[model samples]
Target: MASTGERDGTGGTDGAETAAGTAAAPAERKASWRLVGPGIVVAATGVGAGDLVATLVAGSRFGYTLLWAAVVGCLVKIALAEATGRWHLATGRTIFDGWRSLGAWTTAYFAVYVTVWGFVYGAAAMSSSALPLVALFPGALGLKTWAILCGLAGLAFVWFNRYAVVEKIMMVFVGVMFVVVLYVAVRVTPHLGDAVTGLLPVLPDGSLLYTLGLVGGVGGTITMAAYGYWVNAKGWTDSGWMRMMRLDNRVAYLTTGVFVVAMLIVGAELLHAAGTAIGSGDQGLLDLGRILEERFGAVTAKLFLIGFLAASFSSLVGVWHGVSLLFADFVERTRAARAQGTGGEPPVLEVARGQRERSWPFRGYLLWLTFPPMGLLWLDQPFGLVIAYGVLGAFFMPFLAGTLLWLLNSGRTPRQWRNGPLSNVMLAAAGLLFVVLCVQQVRELPW
Candidate 1:
């Protein structure tokens, strides 16, 4: 295998020509459709039920006035994803390692956020995944039972299978959900003039915040940060894989962009025209399904529900698996430090050898996300937990963008792979937009 540094063209102990010579043989191997794996899964996983609801509500409330926002969101995600993949390929380091370079502060923040975020997210995700199932198969199983089953099934799927198998499963769900959503959008047949106007790039009165939210919300989550790990897992760790990575990122976000645009069309033509509003929670999706039944008939409603179930369940599994990897990586790093005695001689050799080994803390955090949060499904989540989730969630996008900017521009990466002027501009703009949204989130907090 070509070392990551050589593949990235980041001249180190090895030179570029030698790296290229090693990678050239693999480069000649014909690329297959099957290689487009984890990117699609990560993208599909990132755009969950909450994202669907958010986009739908935006369309219903603002019509296609925010279509541009959705497009912008896709662009921003592409930039972020590409940067992340670049870091992995270039530095031969996972995103966790990249973040650690920024400072201990970054790692510390992520440590707390991952734990708190996973616990709450697990229950919420499983419950949301369960709602459509409960609606479809009433009395067959209680909601909590279904939720637990979904969680366990997801856990099992990831625990046993490797990356390629999991990617195939997620891609199937992505296809199902994508087709259903596109079909619904086609059924609605939104106004061309209104959609064209929405593309004109102007935020209307009283719509600035909604525009920002729509743009920022487009197919994003902590899992977006997980893209690098997925790429690493796929064995795409060199600059030779750069073209493939870019292609993967492009296709994933293009699909996601289309999905969001379709939802916007549904919102604009169906809900907005009918003066209908989706409710605020996962239940809101159930309410929308009923409305679809009334207007379009039972088949259409069922299809929509299927799409919802796929979206929710796929995301449930996606987060369960992807975040677990991240948690594991975080814990492994922490444990290595502890094992070496802080002020004593470093255990650099042990840490290096065990860098990829799974740690107890990783599995512990996974269980933490999967089990303890089951109680919260029955009761109100603690105020502190909710507040922390909200705050950390808001900060993630900016944190991701800013860190990518810093890393990509740093001496750590090869100059050829560093952010070009155009990429930097897009990333900087994304960073600014996310910063503004983060401020809004903080300002709007109840406390």
Candidate 2:
């Protein structure tokens, strides 16, 4: 039986009950803030070292002119994340289960993508997380040694912890990251007038590509597809949680917007004002740290380095936990399909009771993300693997958007939960935007 509070006018509950429940809307919205874990985890996980570097680079080149693009990026991601969460709560099914319903091809694509993407990403994420630590303690160990230690630490942490524990840890890291980044933003003193003006759309000369990148890349990744799993992990497993999930989704992007805006301010005031260029990749953050030390002092620089580590390590553990949960679901569904011999269509498996955190498939992917990637720390990343990673990454957002457009508007979803006109427009825009961005990324890749 659906609760009166959850059934809106459009939902197919008793009309009298929905009319009577309208008065409680205010209280439910007010209480939604307390149920905000999955969004924070998703936002924190999405804004890793790469996002910081990209925003910094944008600030370095264009100052506040591209601020609107970052804001747009957050809005776009909010739509994606909201759609993902809505699916889980509305349908009472995992994302993998939805993908399986699409076809075996979806499963095949994910199988290849996750395996390759994780292998390469594991090494990159470990390396990114290691940079700040290596910078902070130069006398302690080599970068590779630090990277291995970081990977193993994340593995052990996620291996032993459940979703509640993981969410709490991620929140602590997000808090540290928020404060440090906000301090840097204030310390540099952004130009209020120009930043406000940036809210209006204006693409500066020679900034078209960077503007598009900022718009498309502020806070997005494969981790977004894992969002529904995180929501499930948090035990929000029914349509009754739909409104709460949407509120949580809004908070997630709002938090992400704040983080990116702060970074843009730091970039505009610190890097642009000084006319300094930082190197690309995670090392770019290190370059910025050195610049901060020169401009301020060692203590300030160390604080920034600590924040960088927080950002990187949060992403590290997030994937270790969130993606591991996704892989665990995939494994469980695959086994269930085999056991029932249900060709490609498996029964919908409820996520509320799975021991996902301790499952072997979960541990196996965690090990895959930890151990094998360490080898890439010593050896050059194979050219083929790098290309594959780039290609797969390019298509992911559009894939997500296109699929959501199909799933959310169809009979697969309940009529009340179907995509409205506004959602349809947003999903369409996201799909087209990402498709264009995907072409640019592929064209720019050194093939």
Candidate 3:
């Protein structure tokens, strides 16, 4: 049952519950910080099939010439996520709380981002998830029909479950994704010499945009901002959890790095070697599936399809669960700040922490992610929304990178937990890179 909370006339939860319930909840975890779960959830969420497809296209075109960029992408994400998680652990406040402290501009950017980004992303995620299903059980259902089913399935899972169940299930899917991708990568017999030489920092001609995309796109998602919430969900709210959080963030990106490299290998050795071309987006994975069947056998093709399904669906549900929690926290934080009238300072509203998963805003956002987007699954996405999504999506990483630098460096964070020199350098570079990518995305849009 949803816990009854103090609500004003407008029906938003008034403040983050400052009661003992929120604090004690973290203590109930028996071996809480010892196990690695949130990182797996993040890895599963961030590295969706679309991301892998982009990596595959890179390999098919450049044949590992951009391999160094992929490695750097992983490192960059580690720094960003570490800074995010650090803010939560070091300050005992949610990221939204920190954002509230930064002034109203942060709020305006996030509000626009989650609203437009969530709707278009829901449809795309469901379509991507359904693609592998349609391939696996070809005549079982039509594409739109499968897409709706996928969306509903994700909705039901996230709606009924809490963080732990979500984490465990995501971990299983991550395992499936890892094994199948690795098998395909190894089966292709990648040239060791080329793989080694590809690690050098040389870019082939005409590959600048692709190189930028590779660096900015790997394992990066809106989910990175949600890492702190996931950490708090695991009952790791204080600086004591900082060590484990850093390790967790590293493991998350390491897993992602492996996924990126393995997919690139499949593209380099299989598609590139054969001089084969595949359609782009999730469809590219389908093209690869057909090739696997023709060359290897039915079993190999089916296994690849299964991995594809796992990758897509894991991302679908991970976003469903994680982002809703983010939205809930977003709502809760905004309401609390207004009630406190913090005069644009960090609201001292961190006392009673309610379970964001059980909050109305969280469930409402889950529904927002699920049902409304199904209309797009049937009809094509409205061209304007698509354009808006692309534009806003382009802006998000830069927004996140820029904000983390701001929040983690200023008085908003405790002095001890502030970003170090290396973190600053990595984040600034990430910010600059994303800004470049954002401009490219806008230029390519059909304005």
TM-score per candidate, chains pooled: 0.90, 0.92, 0.91
Give the alpha carbon lDDT tens digit for every residue of 4-51 in model 3. 111211111223222222333232223334578888888789988889
lDDT of 2 by residue, 292-335 (tens): 99988998899999999999999999998888888887887877
Q: Where does candidate 3 have its weakest 10-residue lDDT segment?
A: 1-10
lDDT of 1 by residue, 354-420 (tens): 2332445645766787889888888888888888988998998899999889877876566667789
Number of colliding residue pairs in model 2: 0
Model 1 global lDDT (CA atoms, 0 to 1)? 0.79
Q: Which pairs clash in model 3?
A: 17-352, 17-353, 18-351, 18-352, 19-352
Best by TM-score: 2
Error of 3 at 372 (Å): 0.8
Alpha-carbon deviation at 161 in model 1, angstroms: 1.5
Q: What C-alpha lDDT values do all the predictions have?
A: 0.79, 0.82, 0.82
TM-score of model 1 relative to the true fold? 0.90
